[model samples]
Target: MTDFVEVDTAAGRVRGRWRPTTGTGRMPRSAAFLGIPFAEAPVGPLRFQAPVPKAPWEGVRDALEFAATAQRGDPGVTLIPEPSVPGESTLNVNVFTPDPDAAGLPVLVWIHGGGYFAGSPASAWYDGRNFNRDGVVTVSISYRLGFDGFGWIEDAPSNRGIRDWLLALEWVQQNIAAFGGDPSRVTIAGQSAGGGAVLTLLGMEKAQHLFHGVYAISGALADVSAERAEKFGRGLAAAGGVAPTVAGFSSLDEERVIALQKKATELGPSSLGSIVEEGLPLGPSVDGDLLVRPTRESLRAGVGADKPLVMGATDDEFTMAFSGVAKKLRWVPKAFLLNRLGMPKGAMRPYLAANQDALERGTAGIAGRLLTDRMFRTAVLNIAEDRGDAPTWLYRFSWPSGTFGFAEHCLDVPFFFDCLDGPAMVPLAGPNPPQALADQVHAAATSFIETGDPGWPVHEGDRGVVRVWDTPVSDVVDGYASVRALREPVS
Candidate 1:
């Protein structure tokens, strides 16, 4: 057994376990400090409010296991595979470092993605051991999810989950040097909702100077307007038979609050069949304080212009959303398309002209392409284009999974973390996934964290360059133009 190592943080001293690197023979072992609290427990009076810094403890606290995670559904019920480790102290952070005494190491703070509803840092796929082996310190954080995190509540702080992330970053800035990480060399990254959080943070005035760079993988950028957010909050409050305030939510049992939140989400209009899908039900709110405007607007106005950014999405991001009956539905109704996407007159001609092969495959294939372009591809492109003076690098995860088929959403996560062998990734990566690709991806990410460049040309000029991750990684120019043109008129 490896020896136990202890590190002192602002809150207290904690002991962590040392584990050797397994797959990569060249890397060294790492020290893992799990379930370290970055904030006070968000229960009781603290429930719906923004996170407060964790109080200092008297003795050495054990950081051996993961802290309780934000509440989520049973693994069996959800399509996404996630860990369900329950506890009161859900606002926690886990750290993996090569040496607690080493100085000047780059740090990567990872925010987990779960559609702004479900996900935890405890999941095996987020292990940072490999990053430690690569001479970087990796920190994975957990924040409030579902209603507790993003549900709009009257009298409660807006974007509480995002606030939690900011606190965690602050903790890292103040304490990471003890673990051999340079506080100034921090890079904040996440996938899916976490990716959205990174974008949201980039636009947040308070988040400036917290991190040097940003990496958003399969990052989603969708939020409701204030009016819509307030309506959703009121609806959830009614579902729970309580006032739409922190006082009412704090009085209810946590489980009841979760159940009512789910009920409220389900009662909303379905995104599956609708042409004009409702924006994400629970996510960062466009509150005047935390977010002055939409994320795209904020970026266009020079938010995070000084921070280098690396962002990308899989080629088939929305295909995973179609399953069971939805998969069989295939094509979206023509009327729904005309009304929902606001396709201009004669738009179909060009879309079909550009995507004849998808049309031949049936509605499902076409719907998948449209959904991907609408939901993720276009949003990412818009963010990239609006990033102003920020040096940006873009990528596309084009390696299709054997089991899931196509380059599905989140397939690149395990590859980026170099955790393809993780059990939670089996269904997504299939067996015998390529390690060579993982090596390249991880190397590039580490390079970005260590330096500002990701070894790709900066995204500028009319035809921006993008690195495509596939069996044979290559670069593509102006790849988004076709899809952007097809969706622009309608968008």
Candidate 2:
């Protein structure tokens, strides 16, 4: 029993700590709450705009420390690392709890991936303490990455890091009910660009209702657009020698435009690389004021958030980013197999005649099943066959990491943040007792954040029931039919 509290938030009266652990066969009593801002501090004229509301503070503040970011590549440069813990209101939020009054529980939040450029939610594999001992509250957010979060500064304001994650889910819908949580039962998970920012905040419309459900691991909603994120912000303003106008690039030198975005991600897969499928040199777009469109045309016009969604991907999402540039590059295996299959000439031959033994793992298992079925199993089967009144759920972690290679790409994020016994979950899920697939993907992600039903069912089509996971718990079916027959569509 260790207590420390302070509420009244919306950006103030902060301070927190509240334990109750008493279940220490190893660890428990959760209820933590480190570093709680939510926005504000883009520094000097709110560099590149969008997230505003973080101003009120007047006392109590503490929040035990966890703030200071955004110099993390572009927007005045620096590429992550130099902040053992600096401060200046880095748009924070970190909560974990068992019962601050534990009302209606079920709130997840999360959202930390690094391809929008670098990561942090005070990373320690995102400590949400075994997801608040499984009753659930667990939040973790902190936006603004590269080019102060997804550069694209021409007329400015494109995915300002997906509008700082929709104002941190509108500050978890007006303050996650004083930390007991249940803001209408939210659930917005992430991984790998925070699983494509949880499928671009489930096709946001200001992330309607803040969030009702969604898991989106692995992430994809392809090539974001808004005129190709303003032509990748005019190629990141011609790699920082400016004049691409955000008023001639806000007086340049945000670490020399993130050291020219680490010299355009070391000039490898340019369009200013570091993954650019749907435009924008940084990430996230459609940008009619913070991603209000394109998530494959809002999941084929069904518009998002029908609710209860869960999603999956890993089965090698690009073998640890092409085994970290395969011994320092050389590529050209036919232009790295046609720019990693953006397709050309022989249109990759129906994905090479449906995997003729995946060309000897050269295309790292067909570029990890075409980057996990075009960025996450066809946008989770197009938001699970376009909402038949929601209830999506889909899986395919296909667990293959006895220390590297299948449960790849941010591997089920420390097995649903139970800290898969951290140390980076043994090169992705191995090295001594991961206690049965981290207690079954943290009990199916806390039983779908406590009762959205994650035991598996809704994914109708080819009867593929998925829940597979490891250490035994079957129900498989469509387990990569040659990566969903190379994601069909080739008429």
Candidate 3:
């Protein structure tokens, strides 16, 4: 344990220790600076608007420990991964580098995904060991989640969470030089909602020049529409027995607002509840400020970011999320299924026509795939199409996990980060681990970040080639037809 020294930041000097780990065959040296403040406390007056920069402190502040994270997946809410720990001042970023004084190493800034409701940068899966070893300084950031970040209140800023993310990037631009990272060669990457946020940032004018490349894994570029966000605000107000205005909302306790958010999730897509509404709501809104417009529109218009992009989704993207829902919905009576699914009373005939002996299994599988594909695979393809001018490296994570074949949603994080090769691989990939597959994916990602190529052809008009990442590398085209069909109507 090297003794921590005070490092000057835009916000004053903070102390951080350097911990050196044994270098792997490829990773010659690695050092991590645990918790560095990227932004000031998002408490008191700075609770709702865009994040304000931390004021320069008078003396050295400790940056040795990880700060508390935003609230995520409390017991009453859904079962998504929550922050291991929670608190108010969750706006912080952690950095890892091979050399603290190495002038201008390429930077890889990561944003974690937890449905925009859960997840934290502190998750073991997000550890930046591999990136640091590969000669790229890595940084992971934490932002607000759930109601604290996403809840809509009139006269208050919307998508405060995404704004928090932008603030972290701005912090990186200003301070990464001290840690030997090149602010000029920054690459932004994210998983799930983080991936979605990555795409959103790419299209925002204010976020231009902040990054030179992007890596989005299993994220939907097209977020909920603005009209839907207003409906969600109404729903939350109804749950709390208050109006949706900022004044009416500020009177309610944090717990009360959180309770309404939980209720919104439970009601789900059909009931116009919250984030998962049937239409569009509960996501980064086109609030005309933080999120200037929809991601699809922003990309199509070619607003600002023109950097190289590496974007992809897992093969079984929706299975993990849908499995939980299918377990409960499978038991519903067939007569009730029609009404619940919004199909006519005699709609079972078309269902039977489409699926013969395994109607239930087929329907569940199709629905699950469609859900994940629309939210991830299709949206990514749409982004690629609009980003025709930008160098694009497309991929499909196809290594089937023995535990959950084809590797369900969010499974690629550990693999690409090189964190799943050891003991932790079993729980996620099962007893008969696919080490060969893991190695292939890891190499492809590292290569893309280091160089410009990911060993796959760039996606062109009709030639939509994607890197089929598995035990061995191969090229495939337009394999996600079902997902394409589902989202074609909207696109």
Better of 1 and 3 by TM-score: 1
* Every model's TM-score: 0.93, 0.35, 0.86
In angstroms, how far off is 142's CA in candidate 2? 3.6
Model 1, 157-272: lDDT tens digits are 98888899989999999999999999999999999888988988987777998999999998876566888888988987887788988888877888898788777666322444
| Angstrom error at residue 260, model 1 | 1.7
The most accurate candidate by TM-score is: 1
Identify the runs in model 3 with alpha carbons over 4 angstroms from their true place: 1-6, 20-27, 72-82, 267-280, 322-363, 421-425, 481-491
Q: Positional deviation of 266 in candidate 2, in angstroms?
A: 26
User: Whole-model lDDT, candidate 3?
Assistant: 0.69
Q: What's the CA error at residue 68 for candidate 1, in Å?
A: 0.2
Which parts of model 1 are misplaced by more than 4 Å?
Answer: 23-26, 77-80, 267-270, 273-278, 330-345, 356-361
Worst 10 residues of 1 by lDDT: 267-276
Residue 456's lDDT within candidate 1 is 82
Pull out the clashing pairs in model 1.
330-363, 330-364, 331-363
